[model samples]
Target: MPAKSVANAKGHSAGFMNFIREQGVVGLAVGLAIGTAAGDTVKQLVGAFIDPLVQLIVGSQAGLKAAEFTLKVGDREGVFAWGAFVSSLITLLAVAFVVYAIVHLMKLDKLDKSKDK
Candidate 1:
């Protein structure tokens, strides 16, 4: 390639990097990755630790991941599958709690403490 072309390419790359940094794209990407991992961790924690405690109390299946309710009327049977919704709610709660704990520990909410006064 010509020297001018090489220099132009280098300039473009540097400009792109500068734009990314200035726009906080790198921080946003890192935050997204960490949020995904934290969600996975919360799922594992709920499944392995919290679910059993819940099961023991409710006398139901672990995490309520499974439940069946059947009704019979006029020779017809109706089935309701509430388990999936319950499990999803549990997961949401777990993720929220984990996020809250992380935020508390990191003191991210304290950034405005001085402003409040």
Candidate 2:
């Protein structure tokens, strides 16, 4: 009985694999490869361009310095690094804006095609 159950489980796993194969494995692989490359490109852009621009606007002190501020209340202490938080927030916003612009343009192109039809 245990052997039969194991065979059934193996058959189910094979069926799932076959289902994924039937769903255009080549296209999925190509899409994943392109996505990984695009991610790397964006990382470079953020590191080289966005980081510098943000540092300029937020001031060099905020960009290069990471100081811990301690808050004490009745012998309890909490430390915070405000500069690191600011830089991270700025980077997040810049990346989000770039993604939004790309998606918006793609949507506009789709709308334009529908209008033409």
Candidate 3:
């Protein structure tokens, strides 16, 4: 390759790497991966432990996922599965809490650069 071509390639690579660093693309990707794993873990924790406790508190044999009521209107019945909604809500809350705890406990939030005024 010509010297000029080699210089241009080097410049392009440097620029690309600079863009990645300045935009925090790698950090964003890492955070996304960690968040996904944390969400899955939190869901399992909620399902295995918190869900059973909720079931005991609510007195539901099948747990929160089976806590639902049926609505009857003029021979028409509609099954409203509110228990599943509660289960999902609990999972969401648990995931958010876990993420918050991880970020704060590790002080990851402080790594972000302050924006220029």
Per lDDT, the best of the predicted structures is: 3
Off by over 4 Å in 1: 69-79, 111-117
Instruction: Please give the range of 10 consecutive residues that has the lowest summed lDDT in model 3.
Output: 54-63
- Residue 20 of model 1, lDDT score: 100
Q: Kindly list the per-residue Cα lDDT of model 3 for residues 20-47, writing each as its tens digit.
A: 9999899899999987987788778767
Clashing residue pairs in all predictions, respectively, total 0, 0, 0
Please tell me which model should have the higher lDDT, number 1 or number 3. 3
Clashing pairs in 3: none
After superposing candidate 2, which stretches have Cα over 4 Å from the reference?
Answer: 1-18, 21-26, 61-67, 106-117
- Best first by TM-score, ranked: 2, 1, 3
Model with the higher TM-score, candidate 1 or 2: 2
For model 3, what is the C-alpha lDDT against the true structure? 0.81
How accurate locally is residue 114 in candidate 2, as Cα lDDT from 0 to 100? 40
* Clash list (residue pairs), candidate 2: none
Q: In model 1, where is the ten-residue run with the lowest total lDDT? A: 108-117
Local distance difference test scores for all models: 0.79, 0.76, 0.81
Candidate 1: tens digits of C-alpha lDDT, residues 1-117: 999999999999999999998988987898899879877887787789877766776667643656768899999999877886786676678668877887899997885465346
Off by over 4 Å in 3: 1-27, 38-61
Model 2 Cα lDDT, one tens digit per residue, 54-115:
76776774544585688999989998887677677777888877666766867853533542
